[model samples]
Target: MRIIISPAKKMIVDTDSFPPEGLPAFLPRTERLLSALRSMSPAALQALWKCNDAIAALNVERLAAMDLSRSLTPAILSYEGIQYRYMAPTVFEQSQLDYIRTHLRILSGFYGLLRPFDGVTPYRLEMQAKLAVDGCRDLYAFWGGTLAEALAAETNLVVNLASKEYSKAVEPHLPASVRFLTCTFGEEKGGKILEKGTACKMARGQMVRWMAEHGIDRAEDLRNFDGLGYAFSPAHSTESNFVFLKGDT
Candidate 1:
């Protein structure tokens, strides 16, 4: 089973924690993207990124000085979003690290798919961004079925812990032979399930850590996850969807 998660927008360089195992699988395609990004002016990039001037300028500098290879941080440690912060990979035991190294895959707009320890530099592209590359209209079109094909090749089961924007790249293209199970972290309202953004992100991170520590390898075992105050809700769950409601477990 491969547990797929989204890459964080906020990133940092931390070469001390761990050295990258290798470069991204899609590095050649990444270089093509790098070329596209480097061609844009700061103002155009700022609009493409939908960020403040400060963020735009910082990324402009990042784009100008970016190096795809050499002196890179591991993909897991590089992301600094709430999800990554909650995962707390820095203190993981060797066995737990090994589990993630094998089971977890990070979805990226720039790099396509990334192993946990894959070498990566900070990038600002988002899956939903409108920046067109080559003849493709957006990142989704550019990636096409490549991500899905790679995941399907690795394992016949994929547990999606990613948001819709990122998951869209793979979900539509996954072959019928590969079973895609999505774990939903939400609350049971008046007979309805509602997913809150920040709370769900925290739950997703915590669940990944919990899964690694426990050596969970089956898609069915995901329903047994009781992390971050979430209880598995059988009533709201289907074979392809595991719903975990935040409250009493």
Candidate 2:
């Protein structure tokens, strides 16, 4: 089984920490995108990033200074978001790290797909960003079916922990042979299933840690996931969609 998650916009660079396993598989392609970004003015970059002045300035510097070949932090350690914080990879044992390396993948607009330990530098681009590269109209179009093909090569079963923006890059393009399953973290409130952003992010991370600790390798095994007050709901779940309710019985 393989699991896919989104890369966080918020990142940290630790040049002295864990040695990067290697560069991203899509380095050449990433260079192509970087070429486009390198040409953009700060204002254009700011628009593309859709962020405030401070974030735009930071990313402008990042784009100007990024050297893809340089030594960098592991992809897992670089992303510092709510999900990553809950996953808490910094304290993981070697065995847990091994498990994560084999099963977890981080989807990115810049890198396309990344193994947990892949070397990466800080940059600001989102999967849903409207920036076009080469002949492709958007990041999704630029990535095309490459992400799905990569995932198919790795495993027959894919557990999607990625948000819609990133997952859309792969889900529709997956081969028929691959079995794709998505886990939803939400709560039942007033007869509706309400999904809160931060809570879902936390649950996604917790689920990954729980899976690693329990040596879970099968999709069906996830039904037993009860991390962070979530319990799998048979009524809310389908063969391809596993829904975990946070506060309901």
RMSD in Å for model 1: 0.9
Predicted structure 2, TM vs. truth:
0.98
Candidates' lDDT values, in order? Answer: 0.92, 0.92
Off by over 4 Å in 2: none
Candidate 2 lDDT over residue span 40-137, tens digit each: 99899999999999999989988888999795889999999999999999888888899999999999999999999999999889999998898889
Every model's TM-score: 0.98, 0.98
- Lowest summed lDDT across 10 adjacent residues in model 1 is found at 240-249
How accurate locally is residue 57 in candidate 2, as Cα lDDT from 0 to 100?
Answer: 91
For model 1, state the Cα shift of residue 27 in Å: 0.5
Candidate 1 CA-lDDT value? 0.92
Q: For residues 1-249, could you state the per-residue lDDT of candidate 1 as single tens digits? A: 999999999999988887999999999999999999999888899999999988898899999999999779999999998888788899899999999999999999999999999999988999999979999999999999999999999999999999999999999999999999999999988888899999989999999999988899987778788877898988888988998997735
